[model samples]
Structure formats: C-alpha cells, structure tokens
Target: MNKIFIIEDDVRIREELSTFLNRYGYESLFSINFENIIEEALKEKPSIILLDINLPYFDGYYICREIRKHSDVPIIVVTSRDSDMDELMSINLGADDFITKPYNTQILLARISSILKRVYGVSRGEILEYRGIIYNMAMSEVTFNNNSLELTKNESRILNILINNNGKIVSRDEIMKTLWQEAEFVDDNTLTVNVNRLRRKLEDLGAINYIQTKRGQGYILI
Candidate 1:
C-alpha cells in the first residue's frame, strides 16, 4: 500500500479522509503535530501528500517549497480558498495538483489515484458494501435497498465512512467532516446538525434507526 500524507489542521477532515483513503488501500497519515510539519512529513517518507493552504503554523506553500528542495514527492494542494492567485501561488511553489476545500470524495480520490499512478505506478479503488447499502466509488453515490440516494458529495462520503466502520462508534468529528465542504461554511456544531439530518434522511428512506449517538463518546451504527 502507498503511504499518503495529509497536512490539514481540521481534525475532522484529516482523520475522516485518512480513514476513507485507508479503506481504499492507501496508508493515509494526517499530521497531528504542526510544530515541525515539514520534518514530520519528511521523516514519514510518504508517496504523496494532500496539503492544505491554511495550516496550523506555516502555510502549505512554504512547506511545499521546502519539501520540493529535497524530494520530488507529489504534492496536491487542498485549500478552502478559491482564487486564481492562490492556485497560481500553489503552482509556483511546486505543487503538482490543487483542489478546493470540501471537495467530493470521488474527485479527491481520482486526483490522488491519478497522481499516484503517474508517480508511483500504484492505484487505489474501492467498492464498499454493508448490509443492504452500496457505496459506488465511480459515481460518488450510495445505493440501498435498490434505492439510489443522490446524496450531496459530503453525505455520500460521510455515509461511506460510517458504513465502512460499521458496528463501531464514529465520533462527531468524523461524520461532520462532510459539512465543511463547498463555498458555504458550517461551524463545528453544524456537524451534529448534519448528522441528525442524515439520520432522518436515512430513516425516511425506509432504513432502520441505524445511527445512534453515545453521548460524549460518539455515534455508532446500531
């Protein structure tokens, strides 16, 4: 499995995406310590990196530049900001690919897959199924009980992540990562709001009470 490094401060995005990537056969590691971001990444020696422009300490561009000086690891910029200048700056700093924040899991996966294939000749793909549900990677959709839910990209991603870890508790941080996507921004508490919405939607679709919250611990699929 190819080791993919992630540099995002949003723990929700970092860990959830890491889980998704891992399920697809890539070893994903997100930076928890930002004190020596570059040093930590270099030490890990990842095949590729998903970098975010807005990081904890030093921004991604500076780190990308520093990394480029030593290694040619493929760097994909994942930024919340959308501007020509930002994209141009990322390219100038030696980033291989750039993606705007709250991106679709399919889009992100495709980018990583493409970059990995080109760089390391390795590709990762997944077709997730649990109970009666299907997570179609190509379409970024969920199919359950022969009924298709054209979910928002984040919803599909959150559902897929949860189902992949079936019978286990997934924290609010994990499920809520989906709400932070797009140009619209939702705060931390909004994760719970989104999960409640997702739960209702799932129930409305004729599914049982699949998700249950465990107070301070997290939510579990029961």
Candidate 2:
C-alpha cells in the first residue's frame, strides 16, 4: 500500500483526510508535532506528502523548499487559500501539485494517484547497475570500478534512460519528454549539453565511448 503523509493544522481536517485516504487503501501518517513537521515528515518518508499552506511553525512553502533540498518526494499542497498567488507560490516552492480547501476527496485521491504514478510508481530503486557503473538513483551518482561519478539531475536522468534501454538506442526526444517532468524546463541545446556533460562524467569514471551517438539516430549504451 502507498503511504501518505498529511500535514494539516486543523485536527478535524487532518483526521478526515487520513480516514479518507485509509479508506481508499492508502496508509496515512498525520502531522502531530507541528513544531518538528519537517523532521517528522522526513522520518516518515511517505510515498507522497499532502501539505497544507497554513502550517503552524512554518508554512508549507518553507517546508516544501526545505524538503526539496533533501528528497524529491512528491508533495501536493492542500490548502483553503485558493488564491492564484498561493498556487503560483506553491509551484515556486517545488510542490508537485496544489489543491484548494474543501477539496473533493475523490479529486484529491486522483491527484495523489496521478503524481505517484508519474514518480514513485515507476520502476526505480535505490540503485541501478548498467554495464560497469552502478547508478545510485537516491544519490544521483554512478559508481564504476570503485570510482564514483556524481551527476547533476539532468545528467543522471539522461544516463539512466540510456542505461535502462541498454542495447536499444534512446532518442534525444524521448529523453527530453521523460526529463521535462522533473526539469525546470529544457531546450534542444540543454539536452545536448547534458548529454555531453554525462559523456565527460562517464569518461571520468572510465566508461569512455560507453555512450555512443549513432549520427541522426540517437544514443546507445554499449
């Protein structure tokens, strides 16, 4: 079952949300210690976070930004403040999605399910090994022959797609589509820059010529 962390100040709303989620087959963890909301949420490490803007000690925006610093867990802002600025701020703070107060339980559940499917629901783990390098998804780094190469988010993602596909070629467009969800946004050159950077990183880790470009085709991990 998917675990959900709820961080709403209103006891009634929190409890109701928990009960609703539980009824829909999700394990719910509520925020009790508002003073240590971030700490507790980190410890819980739910599959997704349901955060309210009107938190006690720190607003959800602050908490969301702090959480983004450590983990990429999907966060959905649940708040009664249904202003355009509030929604914009939520996105600016790295919220995966936003919902207004008096939200329909079904809609909330749908949003949660959609985000999780797009993120954690995918087949990913702490580590992925391809050829000689072990891609640590958690750390966004690849290790080869005892040497570790740290990767930027885009670099890691590009390598991961190629590695995951293995023998088959992975098109640049395909990579862009997959990464657009996590990236701030990218253009054609951004992908080229990331791939070039990834090539250098791989070479540094002794995987020279590992990622091959097929000229007009795409890239393949050999």
Candidate 3:
C-alpha cells in the first residue's frame, strides 16, 4: 500500500484526510510534532506527502525545501493560501502539486492518486533510451555517458513524454493535460517552469540540444 504522510496541524483536518485516504486504500501516516516535521518525514519516507502551508513552528515551504534537499518524495501543498504567489512558490520549491483549503474532496483525491501513480507506479526495470541517454522510469533517474542524476516527479514525467515522442513536437496543452488530467487547476506558467527545469537538467547531464523549442508549436526531442 502507498503511504501518505499528512502534515497538517489541524487535528480535525488531519483526521479527516487520514480517514478519507485510508478508505482509498492508502496508508496514512502523520505526526503531531510540528516542530520536527522535516525530521519525521525524512525518517518515515512515505510514498507521498500532503503538506499544509500553515503550521505551528516551521512553515510548509521550509519543510518542503528541506525535504527536497534530501529526497525527491512527492509533496502536495494543501493550504488555504490560494494566491498565485503561494502556488508558484510551492511549485518553485519542488512541490509535485498544490490544492487549496475547502477543496473538493474528489478533486483532492484525484490529485493524490495522479501524483502517486506518476511518482511510484512504474514497472521495475522500465526504461526509455534516446540518443544514448537512458531514462529509467522505475528509478526516476537519467543515465548518460556513465553519469546518473535523480529527477523530481514532475521532471521525470516531462522527460518521459518527450522521450516517448522523440522527433515530434509535443504541444504544451498536450503535455499539461497528460501531467495533470485537470489542466484548469494548473497554472499555464507552471508547465513552463517544469519544462525549463527539465531542460536544465538535461543540459547538465550532457544532453545539450536534445530538447529544442518549436517556436510556438511546443517542444521536440531532436
């Protein structure tokens, strides 16, 4: 069973989410120790995390940033802060997804399910190779010229789509729809951020010029 780590400080909300997720066959784990949340999360190593922006001691942004420094565990920022800046900051800090407070339970559940599947549902030893660069889906890392680098959930997903459609231009709309089934909830800018980040990673991995912009069409793996 996939373990979901809940990081909301509200006892009632936490309990509700835990119960709801449990009904969906997910193992829910949480800690009331708000101050040491980062430590708790890293130690537990859950499949995914539901993090609230507001907390007792350290905020979710700090916890998220700290966690990304150590692990690529998928984190969904669940908060009442629905401002564009808040969502952008969460995404910039490496959150896999974001949902506001008083959100529809079904939508939240769907987002959780989507992220978990993208992050951890790949078959063992599954990989895609293009121009000598290898993307290992199961490991969420890319190997090129004997160098290996881990990828965040979103980065890996974006790369996966590009590699599968090699030599073709994939429109932004299609990529966004594939990444988040409900594209309306996702900001158009978010996709740009993820694609740019992925491009940088690829460049660092010595796959420079592998992904090229089609100038209004979208991106293509050349």
- Cα error, residue 70 of model 3, in Å, equals 0.5
Over 1-222, each residue of candidate 1 has an lDDT whose tens digit, in order, gives: 789999999888888888988877789886678879998999999999889988777988899999999899999999888899999999999999988977767557767776877787765664455665556665666655656666666666677778768899987665665445442355766667667776777776677788788899778776
What's the CA error at residue 93 for candidate 2, in Å? 0.9
TM-score of each: 0.58, 0.55, 0.55
Candidate 3: stretches off by over 4 Å: 122-222
Report the candidate with higher TM-score, 1 versus 3: 1
Worst 10 residues of 2 by lDDT: 120-129
Per-residue lDDT tens digits of candidate 3, residues 56-130? 999999999999999999999999999999999999999999999887565565566557657777322345667
Candidate that beats the other on lDDT, 1 or 3, i.e. the better one: 3
Predicted structure 2, TM vs. truth:
0.55
Whole-model Cα lDDT of every candidate shown, in order = 0.78, 0.82, 0.85
TM-score of 3: 0.55
Q: Candidates 2 and 3: which is better by TM-score?
A: 3
Clashes of 2: 0
**How many clashes does each candidate structure show, in the order listed?**
1, 0, 0
The TM-score obtained by model 1 is 0.58
lDDT of 1: 0.78
